[model samples]
Target chain A: MSTLNLTAKAREAATSGDYSELISLVPYAKMIGIECIKLGDELVFRLPAQDGNIGNPTLPAIHGGVIAGFMEHAAQLHLIAAMGGQHLPKIIDFSIDYLRAGLYRDTYAQCQVWRQGRRVANVAINAWQTGQAEPIATARAHFKVD
Target chain B: MSETTIRPRAERFLSVLKHCQNLGMTVEQADSQGLILRLPYSDSIVGDPETGVVHGGAITSLMDTTCGISTVCVLPEFEICPTLDLRIDYMHPAAPGKAIYGFAECYRVTPNVIFTRGVAYQDDRDNPIAHVVGTFMRMGKVTQSEALTKAVNEGRA
Candidate 1:
């Protein structure tokens, strides 16, 4: 457990399958304003647009690295929620494909755990701004589960 | 060749990236080989509070930005190149309390795409924290193609 203490309510939420507390524990996620929501059995990540997130002011697009980071964080959170917090996965490698420029607007990501072995897991993630029909980026990540 | 001519252009290009400024990335060196960018240590980017390790996301940003800068150095004129794909492999956790540096080189540039490879290290180049390979889609008109050809000729000269 990290030294950052979660309120009893947050702990309760975690026990009830809400992962916002677990996501909040990550310092970078906090820096970038990442939020998690549980919709039925699915977990989705959201990143609200901020002035600091813009990489190219001319296009007014979100930074490519920021979009990649957000997707990576989403994969980690999805793994945590799936594993029931038994272990924290360490990223081994990440590959991202930028399909389109991430517009300066709210971005959402959904992760699908492709495989979860005893010692490793592979996750695929897609991020979209306007709708899921067209994703801004897609990523695949491998993590070491101990 | 003159600092008076190159420095401001580089600085002006970097100023447009707000996220780069937020991460406090600075151009440490730029030459024919490539460009080296430094990312100052910041607590705001720590991924593991327990170990105080900077987040991998920040390192990715640093390398991506370095690759972009390296492309600029290789090209004759500045152009907007969006990252088409990037792959990063982490070798080890970055040491806390030390600034990370990313050195990137553009290896190949075609009419529409640029290929780059980079390494992120805290202290020793041989001992890199991460290795990154990326492709960027070169946007804008083909006028810069002549500029790139001239730059290559100058390098060989």
Candidate 2:
């Protein structure tokens, strides 16, 4: 019963049921809430914190796994939206950069889609504790597009 | 249980990770301010590859987990926090057949949020393979024991 279950558990929750293949084979991207986000694309997603509110003492900061999960979900959602629900893109490479510290406050990630080339899509996403201007972390991802 | 008992944190996130065995991540050290974690080579996965080396997700998970642990170490009680976002930069591929280690430091800790940075390196330790930064959100707090036991009765996301 450890507190650090977000990365893996989120993996389970997102990739559970039928997403095992994509999650297991693709080390780069992870699953989030039944959606799979390519780790390498710039994407945005929002979900209720399992804990309900913002940061508190029981768990002092944001969970790392939760962040990863969010990126994966956001990327997928962005791709789906771009495709008009036509195809699924797989994550090829992704990167993240932490810019500032965030309090366990109501948070969301707003993603910026930079470019999409044949067979690949490039994306950038920002995680904000407050808004896009106050992003604490940023992510870039590449996905294989059909 | 009180109303606050929800989304509990792992009593020993690293220790639990050790039990995973498959992920191949290890917690080398931990304290209030920071943590050191390692990713051992899996028989199927090599560290030094011609393409650069170990998988990137492995490094991300290691960095992310340690950041979460570093946040938990400073907490007075246990709360289930979620990683709002993460950023990682891969300088080069790590060498296979070697251990990869990460050093994570928490820059801030509030009741609801945590911010952190981590660097991953090969055996030399000085030369890093990747640099990582992320934010963890403590959504709510709960008793550790209760959290472990609750799995039997409830379904959570």
> Which model scores highest in lDDT?
1
- lDDT digits (tens) for residues B66-107 of candidate 2: 666666556665555556666776676777667888887878
TM-score of chain B of each: 0.84, 0.74
Worst 10 residues of 1 chain A by lDDT: A5-14
Quote the positional error of residue B130 for candidate 1 in Å.
0.3
- Per-residue lDDT tens digits for candidate 1, residues B1-157, read 4434344445556655789999898888877677788999988888877678888888888887888767776666666788999999999999988999999999998989999999999889999999999999888544534443333334321
Task: State the displacement of the C-alpha of residue A13, model 2, in Å, after optimal TM-score superposition.
Answer: 29
Question: Chain A vs. true chain A, TM-score per candidate?
Answer: 0.90, 0.62
> Every model's DockQ, to 2 decimals?
0.53, 0.09
Kindly report which residue stretches of model 2 are placed more than 4 angstroms away from their true locations once superposed.
Answer: A1-113, A116-121, A124-139, A142-146, B1-11, B17-20, B43-52, B143-145, B149-157
The digit string of per-residue lDDT tens for model 1 on A1-146 reads: 44554334234545687666655666888888898878888888999998987887655788888888889888987887777666667889999999988998999999999999999999999999999999999999999988
